[model samples]
Target: MFDKILIANRGEIACRVIRTCRRLGIRTVAVYSEADADAQHVRQADEAYCIGGPRPQESYLRGEAIIEVARQTGARAIHPGYGFLSENADFADAVEAAGLVFIGPKAASMRKMGSKAGAKELMQAAGVPVVPGYNGTDQSPETLAREAARIGFPLMIKAAHGGGGKGMRVVRVLDEFMASLESCQREAAGAFGRDRVLLERYIGQPRHIEFQVFGDVHGNVIHLNERECSAQRRYQKVIEESPSPFLTPELRAAMGEAAVKAAQAIGYVNAGTVEFIVAPDGAFYFMEINTRLQVEHPVTELVSGLDLVEWQLRVAAGEPLPLRQEQVRQQGHAIEVRVYAEDPDAGFLPGSGRLERLRLPAPSAHVRVDSGVVEGDTVTIFYDPMIAKLIVHDADRPRALARLREALAECEIGGPKSNVEFLERLVRHPAVVGASIDTGYLDRHLDEFMPAAEVDPDLLLAAAVAQLLAQERAARERAAGSGDPHSPWALADGWRLGHAGKRELAFVHRGAPLALVAHGSGGDYRIEHAGHDVVVNGARIEGDALSLRLDGRGRRFRVDSDPHRVMIHDGERRLRLEPVEVYRRQSGGSAGGEDRIRAPMPGRVVLVRARPGDPVRAGDEVLVIEAMKMELSLKAPRDGSIAEVRAAPGDFVEADAVLVTLEA
Candidate 1:
């Protein structure tokens, strides 16, 4: 095996590769961008180097710079961990040319399988089952539209050089086809530097199942069962598992054979995945082949009991396959959930901020966490927002799922918004638990998944009242006149004799304002107009916050005295309150409306579709902003004349930056 290897990537996958390398006694080198200078993966590596700026284009994708780092560090091999330059044939060739081993498939094989159009043609020629669509090299808009019509409505317009769901669109009718086509082309060009696209018949009830295939220099290849990646959102996989619950023994055998055949057809070596779109009718069609270690490789590793990274090292060092196809066996079921720093309520938009706290669930024999971040780390908008991959392994699928759910519940992340609750709901969804999943599952049940309801007002009030009483008790204890330091009467000495005095306290719950009234009493207090009469006992003050036992709920409310913000922890949910300040406003007449276009988030402007004096309708694409590895099109909010265009292509923008203005 190679003595030292360089990981040409960052994030969880980089850390994952380093772990395996350490186990095999191979020293690892990590490359990072400015954004990841203090990242977890950098600390885990034996040696590290900063490649470039925060953006992937300036850092991870700089294949030549990474190759130089590997050379300077005297690394014998370079492992392209999943994204960035992993599937770049040129990068692989550069490594090989520099006398360093590329720890993946040969460059020739990658070239053949890199493009979706080329791979489909190769698969068809090799007699592999491919989807019925237009794989021809025709880029004319009319020609593609005609092919889409022939393939029928509800077809997929996929970028020939796409992955991670970028540059992909599903058009359900002819009316949406042309616009979607243009959008897909623009995104594809921006993401992959390729505008070529292909049409595929959309499978209604399709399950994404892919086999993990490995090969050695001696041409021996074997399949390591399969992973079901059907749980997806926005065409990107969210949860993955192996072995697939829907796959029977017979189907597994057939799919395994087909995967091996597909690999052999392209002279594939090292670790690669043969992805298939398996239909409900038991027919599987070759979607495409990933020419590197997959992001969800941990699931297969758990079931197969193999270190794919170690295998990559050994194979790159000119070793033969250690085990044959018949020798490999699936041991147990494993499930992996990709935890991302995104807000599910905000269209799953990427959230960026410093991580205040990251507490992982205690690991047992079955649970494993592969993470590339920690507390105090900043989640920026420069790359993918995936925080970690939580994997659970058990003897059965149900047991694995149960462990996964428990682990997710136990994990606590207190920084930016995340989809932890959404993930919990997804795994427990009846269709997912019952193994009745498909690509369209999330889209069909979006309403049930994402609900827009305000929190229970009574619960919020109870928490606020509990907090107020606790604070009063603590203040009394700290007073100098109280012989009993913890006496509640110390602070109540100033209460008026005739009637109860009420003080207005402001509370903000879930971004909404609330006014709370706290009435003074000897030892107990009544919350006037509160949804529930919350009684607090055994009050204890910790720092600026107070802890109280209320209503047998075991609830804890931490009140920030200065900000007047209270955090109510009621087991599963948290209620946040910020004091609502009343401000006098000037009375005025109804204001006239004006048209404005704003950037949704901080990003670099990629395209400007309109300029001043141009007339546009509502919903017309006015500009495109690239952020978090995805392109978001800023549309015209209303029918108007373009009055101003402030942003140009290649200009950086901040959140809510004015990109355009329209005249009503």
Candidate 2:
């Protein structure tokens, strides 16, 4: 085994590689960018170095810089942990040229599989099942249009070097073909440095399943089961699971054979994945081959009882195959949910800010959290927003799903918005629970998955009462000097009065206010509101927060809260209460009355579609902003003339930055 290895990536994968390397007694070195100076992965490694700026091109993607770091740290091997330079054939060649082992497939194999078009041709030549599409090298617009027509409408235009949904577009109509083709090419060229694209017939109700394949230098390859990855958004996978719900034993065998064939065709070695699009009729078509460890490898690991990274390192060090295909067996079901720092309500735009509070679910025999961030860590727009991969394994699929749901519910995160609520809803959806999933599942059932109704009066009242009681108890503790001895209440003298003092507490529940009167003293009290009297005991007040026991239920509430707004936690969901003064009118708002265009997210302006005094329509593209490797187009809000173009191409702008103002 290698004595020392350098991880040529950052974030969770880098941290993941470090763990395996340590277990195998291999010292690990980490390289970071300026933005990640105190990143989790950097702190976890034995040695660390700063390569360059925050952007990938200047740091992580700089092969030479990474190689230099490996050399300086005396790392004998370089593990490109997925993304950035992981699939870059040139990077692999450079690592080998520096006399450092590349802990992945051979550079030659990567070169062949890096291009989707080339991979398709190779797969077909190897007698593996491949989708009928145009994989030729013709770049003429006319040829592409012709190919699209031949392939039929509702086709997919994918970048030859695309992954994670970048540089891909799905067109269902002939009229939208040309524009989508051009856009796909532009994005493909910008993202992958390749304008080449391929056309494939869009398979309706398709399920994305990928097989994990591993190989050694001794000409042995084996499959490690399949992962169902159909739960996706924006063409990127969101949730994945092992032992696909739709795959039978017979189908699994066939797919496993095809995965082996696909890997062998490229002389693949180390760890790789063969992705396929399975149709509703049980027919599967080859999608592409990833030439490195996958982001979702944990689910496979959970079921296969093997550390893929360790295997990769061992294989790269000239080790022979340790196990044959017949020896590999899957033990149980494992599901992985990708927790990302994104706003689900805001079209899933990546969120960036300091993680003020973070409470991860405890790991047990069934749960594992692979994370690269901690509380107070800033999630910048410099890289992928994935914060952690939460995986749960159990004896059965239903048990695994239930454990995963519980785990997600226990995950507490604050600061920037995230898709935790959305993920929680998705896993609990009826169709999802029934294992009836496809690419269109989310889009088709969006209305059914809106935030759960807030009209449960009983639950709301219980939450409010719990809050009030907790507050009263905290107040008693403060008065008795039993809590926070430095508190001002501890210094106050208690005076007996003929009549108990009444304090009016107003709280908003489910967008409505409830006025309650606190009666009695300290341990014994009754809260009266809405013609109902609730007995309270053991009430305590600390500062503005409250804790109390009421009617066999434990409730905690915060009062003396923000006068304008208060937040209530009901153990399941958070309720926001705002004073009437701060509430805005929700009805009859003017639509598209101005031409002002705003940047959707913080990013560099990549393209300015219009200039000052330019004529524009209500929905015309005004500019394009690039953030987190995705391009967002800013559009005119109304039909008007462009009065000013405040931002030019290459200028950085923050979220909601005004870019173009329209003249009425």
Candidate 3:
């Protein structure tokens, strides 16, 4: 519709918008920070510009700088893809004031829905069912405490202007109310630039259902069914699906109608999502409305057979509704899982580093991968640490689930730890398989989804074989160069005059020592471990797969390895193994006795709980840092006196930097 448009965001959403704009013959302009100078979005766009530094406030969130880029590139419209300034009403108004289309809802609509408290009040007036809670404008602490007492225990304290699971807390008891409130307000102030909060009655074991709502200037609004996002961890959706399996036809129609009402009440234009929390008894209440294209919109697109971005473009160009309410249809089931750069076992700590070996399932008609990164990209701590969104669609839910497992198996991520294995386990858990998962289920039953601490013997064996074979191959390749290829020392295949000497290899898995002795070579070997002997044949690595035969039985595994680490995926789970030297270095003895505390990940220091000369116990909170949209408290390792605090509040430190020092 327009000759050019600028994407006011980065990452996968920006890349996604560029694809649609390119398809429509519209030139796309991308703006990035210093950290993202070589980003995939920049390379893909027709024109690109560097706005500012790496941090969001320095670049992506600078509405004026982005507007200037659009003007310079001659972009007629700007797409604020889902995050950052997408929900900022002032930014939308600024764009319009600069004579460029915002490409989303009207500024008035955004302003009305910008605050959760205001949105809830508006929804209630529009006849949409809203949760019974406090949304009043009383800003005093005493008023909030009074409201909490009246509302009873187990209430939710949510930031009025925050999303993405930030600035939210659940208070379960009366005494814990003030502390939770303080924490929630502090986070809200830091993240959203506002400390205002709203109280809601916390619903236990609730299912998160959100309907995709679209509206145009013609005042026509329609619903695109609903997405079931109940599978979550810490209020963040882990997996999302369309046509909620828990929803009956009658309930679906009712919620869909109410979603339309909420959108119409705000005069929302372009694309938006109306989220609801449904209780077990079929009672649903309005949670909030996301005022732009959602991250999980692909699942809706796959099921509804429509491109939501294209619709956003047409709507911004003054086109009428693409189809009426009666014509909206959902064809099949679609599911999406967000793969993030995080460690699930380690308190879900977010990670950032170069993707040493990144591989994903090839995209096809039934499968799609929305990502802004590739194999060599570094997932800096400057923004969200999401790697990609893996989506799968099929004729039905069962088939879709089956395809998802296969697709997950094909993925192999190296370097920064990921939740891919955790997600794989979750999909097979009984509750997930039966479609009975709830928002708190993952947190309650997290142990069930975690792999056993001890690695499987078979898995360890595969790791040993893969490493030995790879080493032998490397030796042979070295021999072929400047040395004699026929030398037995170079081959190192247990060669001898009488009988081949057994080659002994030592490995470690989950802190357990593993010893293996191999005989023979060249894709054939007899291996011994734990006083047990077996014959292995056809052991070779092709790409990432390792196929081998042990004791006349065939086995296959996905192997990602280096001199330091060995990752073996045996169809269902991943096992981390390492050479004895590497393992020993990793399990360093000084880690626990270290006097200084290093920053776990790159982030800004938000609090220093202990100053120099302050006494603290082992479990006392010493400092707190926020990274990847979550807060991590650094605690004292042992009872000691703080000797120094290197960083202060608002100081951005790199990973492994010593931020605080204790008495040595």
TM-score to true structure, per model: 0.83, 0.85, 0.92
Backbone Cα, N, C clashes tallied per candidate: 2, 19, 0
lDDT of each: 0.81, 0.81, 0.89
TM-score, model 2 to reference: 0.85
For model 3, what is the alpha-carbon lDDT of residue 187? Answer: 92
**Candidate 1 weakest lDDT stretch, 10 residues:** 582-591
How would you encode candidate 1's per-residue C-alpha lDDT over 1-664 as one tens digit per residue? 8899999998888998888888889999999999899998999999999999988989999999999999999999999988788988999999999999999999999899878999998888888899899978878988998999999978999999887788989899999999999999999998889999999998888999999999887889899899999988777888899989889999999998989999999998999999999989999999888899998998988888888888888888999987888988899899999888888887898876787667666667899998889878988778888888899999999999889887776655666678876887788778889999898789878766652356655446545565556556667657755568655455643365686666566665444556656564433444544455555444555663345555444444433323234444333444544455411121122122348888766788989999899999999999999888878888888898999999999898877777899986
What tens digits encode model 2's per-residue C-alpha lDDT throughout 71-111?
88899999999989998899899999999999999989988
**All candidates in order of TM-score, best leading:** 3, 2, 1
lDDT of 3 by residue, 56-78 (tens): 99999999999999998899999
lDDT computed for candidate 1 = 0.81
